[model samples]
Target: MATPRIESHAFPRSWKDLIGHERIRSTLSSAIAKRRLGGSLLFVGPPGVGKTAAALLLAQTVLCRRQSAAEMNPCGQCPDCAQVRAATHPDLIQVSKPQDKSLIPLELLIGPVEARLQEGFCHDVHLRPMQGERKVAILHDADFLNEEGANCLLKTLEEPPANAVIILIGTSEQRQLPTIRSRCQTMRFTSPTGVEGRELLRQHIQRLTEAGQSPPSLADAELDEAIELAAGDLQVATRLASGQSNEIRGKLLTQLSASVPDPMIIARCINSHLDEISKKEAPLRRAGLRDLCSIAVQYYRGELREAARQGRYNGADARRLDRTLRVFREIDRSANLNALVDCYAADLSLAITGDRGSIG
Candidate 1:
């Protein structure tokens, strides 16, 4: 196996440090406490949620040298806990997609599809732990597993190594191969909202402070603005803690509230701002588009509600709003940002003036 340098500087010290995911924490704690922990686990959830963090916590709990039968929590002070935290535990094998490639290569698991027991994560997992009682293999970015790579893991999943746990981290069960999903116990994570979201944000801010890092000075309203734009996403909320969210939200609101909104101008402004946010990366650009689309939807929904309150409801307004959402979905899936921008501009024009011919 690759014996790269490992450190716990990036991870939380204990499960309690993980924000939100109360149900996930309880279920995992019970499993650990009852000694009913399965050998294969699939953590499925949206981005920025604590799925990977939960998986790591489970590893820490299993490898903790100081816990008793009555306790399921990691002591965060034991040598084993420190090793696991630092990712230096000989029993723990963590694998993920290489930075340059999109998919987790089959070679990472097996030397070749035809090879029988060559060196790889699968082979390494089967070997007995060098230090701890149990081996824990954490495979991150499991969504990027190709058919061949995933199939190679089936045999091990079906008949796992004794005293070992294999945790696969993915965004959704649907994205994983059926065979892989069937062989593993699945846990779904949901993004926290409302009080939960706010609490999570507060905890993260506290962590930053504890780390001796100074975040941008933000007022209560500015903090709330970031949280509101984040829509219960902790990672997004944390990124917004730097005050970038306010700038983006302001631009979006200004465009929406323009007395005579020009679709071309609005689209250009949005694309320009998103380009800055994304730094020209296609994936980040798409994410920026999605965020802008969410803001636009909120604006249109408010307009529709206002019209209803005034007893001047227009079916066309609702229709345009729905179309804007559809366009957002399309933009998210499309690769050609330029073409998507044109389509988005046209759609926004339709919403603004009810004229499809306003922009080509």
Candidate 2:
């Protein structure tokens, strides 16, 4: 077959464009160099830690036209590398959530995504590349793949096609799949620091300026504010910049800044957030716990930061906030919340009268 034209929208082409996760990057590079790269790679990380980005970079490396037996990562300017970055390389497949929903429904596993999987898992890998060296299938949000979906993809996982690579990316506890998980080499990414995140915002700005386009999603202060709210999740910061965050950081900050001296209101705020998530959070699901704990931590950090900055909150209000934070942490750590929050509510009320001993 003739080499197809590279088709993806060109993105910032290398791992360099993605901030932090240096450890994960180094491991992947080493694997590629040793030609010991696994057919199945599990990128386990917090959201926005560049799991998806690194996967794409690896895809480009695997399919690079110039890669001989010698080099692993492709020279980005090469046709194969460019094509992968643009998301158009013929042999590369990008599988993500179903367009209509927030997740990949089970039907999709046996549908278009799997149809492609069927072709390449066995016979296709042995065939020469359509235009480049290998076929790539990137499974984003792999954790959302239900049991049936996971089983459906097992054939490929068990016996990946020759010269073929499958990349699985998922966040938090969803990152692991016991049977499938055992088969792959896992690369983990963590949230970067406020400092690192700000630096990335600067680079994004430079890129936007050079392109003569509207600058990237954040102004420096906006990025800092967002990173603080997100507890350093770049993906969250990006969403905030884009006005797409599920939670409005600015509005929340505003509310927190108001001089509400009432402990009831503080208790109520804590109840509302926990209540919204109570049913789904059993504290048993690792993914759910990870998300919940992270959120609570961020909330407390934001509250404290706001309180200190505004200086509008009295000690009673601050005490209630602190109590809520501690209780949330306890819940996150697997404490039974039905009783904990009730006691927390009482302490929050009594805390105003100078009593902190009984809640414990």
Candidate 3:
């Protein structure tokens, strides 16, 4: 498969180019200036924030031969900086969950157990840097690190190579093992502000123009609605700006407002719409699930407000709504859209009608 070519300037090459997390950049700069950078660090945040970008920028800066610690910037012209940007630097390593499987396999971290620790991420980090002053290994799917994998990494986290930095990136701290979390310095990232979200959307639009691709047909209130719906996640905002959200929202409003809710009917309706989204693999499939779930939540929130206005709010109704939300949360964790949709649809029916319901 061909790699997507990002317009040069659209790719985040420095801290300044990253979309959000202003304080994270400042704090990292201070650490570099004081030489207090931790050997092991964990970046915890929601998806589409600047965690990965910040990690890459910091890695490039750390490996830049021409930059002083006080400078805290990569000399972009250096061989080290160029290679890092192209992801070809020998000293920079990145590992993520493979598509075929759900978890980050243990071997990807420390090599096959039979290798006797002779090769792998852990073993490679122990060796001297092949090109730069230090090695930077980024574990991208830290949330999927199993017990054995986390244990395999513990030693390195405790006493890392003299000039190595190991950074774990994950969505939430709670998803990581306590033992692993305790040893690493943690950086928490938050969603961008409303203004920042709009700016990020515009930047993406500009990139489309530069790439000679027509931008999505959305403007003014519709664009703002997408930005607000995205809640500061740039990737989600991009999808929303493409007008997918409006289509999904329209379907959700009609079905959720039906006088006689039918879980099976609603489930089939959603399943059909999502099936038409594209045969384009996992990420799109996963995004469709997320968008549907978000619409359901948003729709119910409005219903809750109206019910309260009519003095019809009650504990049982609230509990049913909570159950519906929990199903969405589970969908995120498991990434199993099919398994949860029926249950979610049933819960939504119950929540709306205050009656027991099940998808037949």
Candidate 4:
């Protein structure tokens, strides 16, 4: 039961406090200052990369009474800013997929069947601001919005209330419906990488230490591995730093590096580790499985690179890397966790053992 060194809920309150996305911050700040920001925007990026945080900051900047939107600054002391910080703002409406549900229900968008358009997000978004001049609606997990939900939202996006700002946060533009994508200004966000990533990790560790939440002394090598494996995701990097990543990585590499890897054993090992990480929560388990798949992708990629460097790269090595990558992609859309894990292990073992004919 390791305590999280960095809480995901601890989001940046201002542009300066956000870690990466310098270009995005600059563009947004300029737009806010010029009062030319769109009424509807889509924030697309990998998870844990500050899409939601930036949305909050934008809402605060627009709603802050002490400073005009032209200032592009939020006076944290203002009631608007304080309410946004505490998620109690009357004008700020937020929605996301429920933990038990796989999709953002249509009812959440347009009220229940008996109360359609009477008491839901769409209905609420149209109301006059109670404490501010404009309403700011943020819809998280936009990727989970089913077709019906997306259709119900089109009206709001097409003709929003005067001075209203609607922000949809998702991982990719392709995941959004075409009609939904066409009506909004899309801002793409990327994870911090290389030197920027390392610096951010250092800053995070320092913050944890200052707050007396730092884990046991971490070696530079451990930090470097975490950074490399995280591939620019700060949340994953922190999880890697929680002392579980090493054990998980060791198990993966040990099985993957064996002379004759066992698919069953690999599958069991991965599922067991996923269970430990997720505590049987299906969504958490899916996320944990994705993280482990990412680690495996890194492993295969390293092997491929090393082999190429030594002039030992071959068709078998290439296939192994390819299969690992495919498995990684499957984790996102697949629902059967146990079957996916089994197939992933079997496919990789087949690739590694040079049994290409038996694969697929």
Candidate 5:
């Protein structure tokens, strides 16, 4: 159980304070006034687009006992409101996909949730809020819920326990479970445009400077770098400002320029750059997956261009190009289900070290 959220200096107070996703906030706010709130809301959006934060706000709004119908928002001053804001409210159950691994098995969710349901929420967690009236569960990175995990969630969604509400946060529709999608009240968030993305990065830079942790004269140029790396994820951008150092652009360019001796060599060159990526498995693998997927798109685009050299493109080449385009279009797709990076490594090794294609 996380700590009850408060309006302390550490926490954000208003929906507008979030960097992106105004439409999402508006929908959630509107829902609060309706007689029947979405018991299960699926927040589908790019990471750092305020999904989880919105979930917390919704939890606060629903649990606030003294809020007026007009505002339909929590009085950040109330104890319940503060607790939920602090992430310490006992009834506010938060579940995240296992960060250590690529996927979350439904089994993990089943036992604990069932046990909690049987015990009537309080037994599973202690220090229930003295003020809040209901239970809220936030399932973050819900797209990683594998078959069993999603089924467990589906069961709960089908028959929600009294006074319990569930919010599922996912990156994209492709990542989400279809049945889960059908069941929940859906809300979608798009990546902020380049301009919005830059503004968000600037805000993070300002906040860090205001904190005195970073020097006031630090180059603001890195703000754009942070935005590009985050791909418009406000959370990622802020995290970068707080010290999550991403690879410098030059290194990535160097890696991409492997000895492209031939068709097979091109693949090997790619693998050579990524060889050590797998070694740093646990903590960095998630980022590795994102990078690998993005790189694959780049590789395919290059291949399609090469294929175009064969003035009359064949059907096979066109199909591969089409698949590549699909992957590019769905930036929010979870690469957890695929083994492309591993396969790329193997194929590249076969080309360079084995009998397949060769490159010096």
Candidate 6:
């Protein structure tokens, strides 16, 4: 069966709707209450978390005409709130790296050669708010900002327009330039885990049902497996709950644990699964392959723990885990997916069967 896509409404619509990040919520709420929220903010966290959603919620709180900002409550029925939700608010400027490009183009920060400083994100941000007292700008994929692009944004970060809030969302603080990191109030977010993660998933499933959407029903075992595979990523868990990844995972574990796993068969199974999930799109296929590798890493680690518990762990077991780790990292730089898969399968087979040979 095909994986169900998460709907827009599934995303957080208010601070209360946002899952996890309790400390962040309290800090921002206190700042807003005291009218001391900074002009430039940096949100650093893993993907599938609520960084962007929190940014939007902040915008709504500051711009909502029906409610006072000090209350830290956005009246969702107001025009300002509606515009922000639809991403149609003139005062809210959002930018992200283009999928086809390796970096966020410098022109996006400033302007094209013919229109330098005349029009672009920097210019748009400096403009006075059209409907409210505040303007909010969010830059997604801030990790893709090249040196020139970062430089162009330096001045804006140093001195944002009055009542303007600029948010840069990325995976880690280390990925950002020193100047960018130093200029903004940084908020770190972590993925939900344990009871929090389980509650988050349950809430999502409940929301789908309440919204009258007929999502696939997950069995208790499947739900637990999805949670384990997702590792706190809600989006991945939703996909796994659809019953696709579970099948692939079962097959992968079975093959990896076999005494004489066939490299050709393993490669074919993985390739076929990738094709199904990615719809023949090369980028998505590569991403799926990396996710599968993450699963393998987990499996191998579990095996090592069990072996150690049984007093049978050895150097070969440690080497096998290391090989899997290397393969996971190399997937991003690999040019030929088929060749990489074939070689990885062969290497894994050799490691499992006590052979010293390896492709890498």
List the candidate 4 regions with Cα displacement exceeding 4 Å. 1-9, 202-212, 216-221, 258-260, 303-336, 352-360
User: Which prediction has more favorable TM-score, 4 or 5?
Assistant: 4
Residues 48-124 of candidate 4: C-alpha lDDT, one tens digit per residue: 67788888888888889999877777887888888887777889888887766678878788888999998778898
Q: What is the C-alpha local distance difference test score of each model?
A: 0.72, 0.59, 0.73, 0.76, 0.56, 0.75
Predicted candidate 5 versus true structure: per-residue lDDT over 1-360, tens digit per residue: 222232344334666666567777666667556755646778888665657667777777777778852374567787777777767765677766544455664434654545634342223323333445567877776777777667656666766655667788887877787888888888887766556666655555565565546533334566555554555555555555444334432343343344332334434443444444554453354444344334444554555567678765444334433443343323233343234443434433233322223211
Which has the greatest TM-score? 3
How far residue 322's Cα lies from its native spot in candidate 1, in Å, is 8.8
Stretch of 10 with least lDDT, candidate 3: 1-10
Clashes of 3: 0
Best by lDDT: 4
Q: Mind giving the per-residue lDDT tens digits that candidate 1 earns over 17-133?
A: 777777887887787678877689999876667777777778888888788523657898988888877778888888887755667877788865577567788898889878768
Model 2 lDDT-worst window of ten? 1-10
TM-score per model over all chains: 0.74, 0.61, 0.85, 0.83, 0.67, 0.80
For candidate 4, the TM-score is 0.83
In candidate 2, position 232 carries an lDDT of 56
Candidate 6 residue-wise lDDT, 1-360, digit = tens: 011122447567777778888898899989888878858999998666778778888888888999997777888888888878877778888888765566787788788899999877899899998988889888888887877889899999999987899999987898899989998899998877666666667665666453457766665666666666655556556556655566788788888778657788889889888888776577777767766766776777778888889988755556666776676435533447887778778877777432335433
At residue 62, give the lDDT of candidate 4: 82
Better of 4 and 6 by lDDT: 4
Q: What is the lDDT of residue 110 in candidate 6?
A: 85
Better-scoring candidate (TM-score), 4 or 6: 4
* Candidate 1 ranges beyond 4 A from true positions: 1-9, 112-117, 203-213, 217-228, 253-267, 274-360
Which portions of model 3 show Cα errors greater than 4 Å? 1-10, 204-211, 217-224, 257-260, 301-336, 352-360
Candidate with more favorable, higher lDDT: 3 or 6: 6
Clashing pairs in 4: none
